[model samples]
Target: MADDDDLLGELLRFKLEAAGHDVTIVEDGQSALQAARSGKHDLMVLDSMMPVLSGPQVLRALTEEGSALPVVMLTARKGQDDVLDALSAGARDYLTKPFIPDELVARVNTILKNEGNRVASADH
Candidate 1:
């Protein structure tokens, strides 16, 4: 997961960890990109307005590189256009800030479960 805001990042990490997830935290989109390139991750929870590169920028780069890694964008922007931009840029899910931690965890679980099902179906 990536977010420049330390408090939010920490809170997110804590919540995810509590939900039995192993998470790696990155402070900026540049580090996020590097981690994505070098590691195997089931999903990404990205913040929209990040330093070095915005969340959508990172998603675009990943898409351009043909990475199939699923992304969930977190943002304070609640505009319809903002959501559209993120979806177009390859975010699988989007959530506005000041959200419930349980909801975030639930979303992550659902995405992972769906992705697992897709992979299993593909193998069949």
Candidate 2:
């Protein structure tokens, strides 16, 4: 997870860890991109507005590198265009700022569940 805000990062880290997913918190986009490239994580929760590379930039890089890891973009910009832009850039989901933690968790769970089904089916 990459969030410039320390509190938000910590909260998300705790929530995810409690859900049995190991979480890594980074304050900037550069480290997040580096970590993503290492392919060490099952998914990435990115703040759309961040220092160094920005969420859209990171998403574009991941897409170009063929990293299929699911990404959920969090942003204060709730405009329809903004959401569409994130989706077009390969974000699996988008959440506006000040969102409920439960909503975030539910969305993450849904995405992971779908992904798990896809992988299991493919293995058959």
Candidate 3:
């Protein structure tokens, strides 16, 4: 997760880890982009308002580099245009701030399940 707020990131990290996922928390987009490029994570949850590169910028960079890693963007921007911009920038899903943790977890699980299914089908 790329979030400048340590508390929020820690909360998310705890949740993901408790659910049996290895979580890495980065305070800025630069580190997040580096970690993503290293191909070490199965998925990424990014905060759109982070410093250094910003979420959309990181997403664009990843896409331009041909990385297929799925990214979920979190932002306080709830406007339609902001959400559309995130999707256009290659976010697999977008979540606004103050969202329910359970909802976020459910979305993450759904994305992972769907991705797993795709890989399984592709191998057939």
Candidate 4:
């Protein structure tokens, strides 16, 4: 997950780890982009606002590179425009800040499950 807020980052990290996920927390969008491009993670929980590169910018970059990495956009921008922008940019899911931890985990798990299924089918 990429979030500058230390508390929120740690909180989500704890929750995700508890649910059997190997989580990596990055403080900025640049690191988030690097992490995504490295192909070390199965999915990404990205914050829309960050220093260096914003989440939408990262999405655009990855799309240009033909990356199929699944990205879950987590941001405080509750505006419809922001949501549409991120979704249109290719985010697998858009979640606003102050989200319910359990719900976020459930959503992440669902996305990962679906992605795994898609990959499995593609390999056949």
Candidate 5:
């Protein structure tokens, strides 16, 4: 996860870890980009605005590089364009801020589960 808010970051980390995910929290978008490029994580939960790089910029870079890593946008931007832009730019999901923690966990789980199924089918 990449979020500038320390409290939210820790809260999300706690919640996600409780959901049985091994979570890594980064405070900036540049760190997020570097981590994503490392090919180590299965999914990323990105905030729309951050220091160094915005969520959309990172998403675009990864898309341009043909990276298949799934990204979920967790941001305070509730505008239609924000949602549309992120989805069109290749985000797996776009979730607005002040969101229910449980909902986020559920969405993450569903995405991961679906991705697992896709990979399994592709291997056949």
Candidate 6:
């Protein structure tokens, strides 16, 4: 996860780790991009309004590099353009800030499960 907010990051890390998911928290988009280059994660939860390159900017770079790593965008901006910008830049999912932690967990689980299914089907 890439979030500028320390409290939210800690909360998410604690919850996700508790739920049997290994979590890595980065404080900014640059670190996020660098970490993702390792192709180690199954999914990324990105905060849109981050320092040193926004979430959409990172997504755009990833897309340009042909990295189809699934990304979920989190932001305080509820505007349609904000959400659309992230999606257009290659976010697989979007969430508005002040969101429920349980909901984020559910979304992450669902996305991972669906991705697993897709990979399984593709190997047939």
Off by over 4 Å in 5: none
Task: Tell me the tens digit of each residue's lDDT in model 3 across 5-89.
Answer: 9999888988888777899999999999999998899899998888899988999999999888999998887999989988987
TM-score of 3: 0.96
Among all windows of ten consecutive residues in candidate 6, which has the lowest summed lDDT? 83-92
lDDT of 1 by residue, 1-124 (tens): 9999998889989999999999999989999998888857889999989999988889999999998888999889899999998898788999999899889899999999999999999998
- Our model 3 lands, by Cα RMSD against the true structure, at 0.9
Estimate the TM-score for candidate 4: 0.96
Question: Tens digit of lDDT per residue, candidate 2, span 36-115?
Answer: 98878889999988999998889999999888999999888898998998898899999999999878988988999999
For residue 29, what is the lDDT in candidate 6?
93
Instruction: Give the residue spans of candidate 2 off by over 4 A.
Output: none
Best by lDDT: 5
Per-prediction CA RMSD (Å): 0.9, 0.9, 0.9, 0.8, 0.6, 0.9
Provide the global lDDT of candidate 6 against the true structure: 0.91
Cα lDDT tens digits for candidate 4, 84-121: 98888889999998899889999999999999999899
Off by over 4 Å in 3: none
Whole-model lDDT per candidate: 0.91, 0.90, 0.90, 0.91, 0.95, 0.91
10 residues in a row with least lDDT, candidate 4: 48-57
lDDT at position 57, candidate 5? 92
Better of 2 and 5 by TM-score: 5
Alpha carbon lDDT at 118, candidate 4: 94
